[model samples]
Target: MMFEPFQRLTSRTIVLSQENIDTDQIIPARFLTTTSKEGLGQSVFFDWRYNTEGRLRNDSPLDGFAPSEFEILVAGPNFGCGSSREHAPWALSDFGFRAVVSSDIADIFKSNALKNGLLPVEVDKKTHQQLMKTPGAEVTIDLESQTVRIGHDWQTVFEVEAFARRCLLDGVDPLGHLIKQLPTIEAYERRRDEL
Candidate 1:
């Protein structure tokens, strides 16, 4: 998992439907068994996003940028819908998505993102409307203050959970975070042993 706290970024983004989109749809059921997170990027949004040969054709909005290159996806409300699998964000972050902006996010998905150090930004309906209209608009996610800016024209402020914020800030992937705090943890263990 890649943890990028202050990612100064630009990209062409697509705003999509707010429906029962889930992990299976995000990366397809075929890839679910894979243990490594790297190649799952190719399968992202498989069923609805690509043709049988897995080619990104002109019909879809995401086609503007090559699948390997696209960085942002502005989605509708209730995104990350369906089963709670960490693989959803795994594919996204592995696929190089720095941030995902939506009207509302599923709680489990948000937590999964935090564990992997992916930024899931939630904005109100008005901001969602503006971003949806911003075809191929580039988005900037400033983790220091948790703000998302589209081009030089508009910006949106968001709220992330405080503990999650600290983890993201220091580039702490979940595993790395636990290991980094291990000294204190070890001390606690030693005290407990004494008890």
Candidate 2:
């Protein structure tokens, strides 16, 4: 699969201000039955966005905002804190979020996200509050510089592992990247056989 490079992204943001949002809440367990990533986007944050009757909640934040208008999510502390399911990141990515900004994120989730080509950005509490304060604001995430630009003249730096950063900037998943180096691997093997 061809992954999109995440160098610089400037798009409207959606803030889920509540803390400790888990994988189940993000996509729910019932939805996890499918191995395919397709259609998972529609179920993202499914429980929160719907009622018990499977009807769209009148007060759903998703209803208030179209997915096309936003590509970034500004979430509260301890985001992605539930089960270490890879589907969570897949759901988020399928839902049109290229990156998620939070004050704190679960380590396993962060690693899963990075592998899936989703940038998980951790910012200071102050910066997180600032981002939440301006929901729908156009935020710019510069993966190249490892910074999130909030509003005019205000920006905060984020940390991503160098290898993960390289993968994201290059738009290649780990397996895909290794696959792309097949020629070099073959050449090395041939040379070793001759020796």
User: CA lDDT of each candidate?
Assistant: 0.75, 0.88
lDDT of 1 by residue, 1-195 (tens): 555563455666766755546667776677788877667666677676677896766576655566545677788777787778888998887777767888888888888877776678899888888887876777777877778888888888899888787778876656766878999999999999999
lDDT of 1 at 48: 66
TM-score against native, each model: 0.80, 0.87
Model 1 Cα displacement at 180 (Å)?
7.6
Residue 100 in candidate 2 has what lDDT?
A: 92
Error of 2 at 46 (Å): 1.2
The superposed Cα distance between candidate 2 and the true structure at residue 16, in angstroms, equals: 0.7
Off by over 4 Å in 1: 1-7, 53-58, 67-69, 176-195
Would you list the clashing residue pairs of candidate 1? 26-45
**Lowest summed lDDT window (length 10), candidate 1:** 1-10
Q: Model 1 TM-score?
A: 0.80
Model 2: per-residue lDDT, tens digit, 86-164? 9999999988898999999999999999988789999998988899999898899999999999879888899999999
For candidate 2, the 10 contiguous residues with the lowest summed lDDT are 58-67
What is the clash tally of candidate 2?
Answer: 1
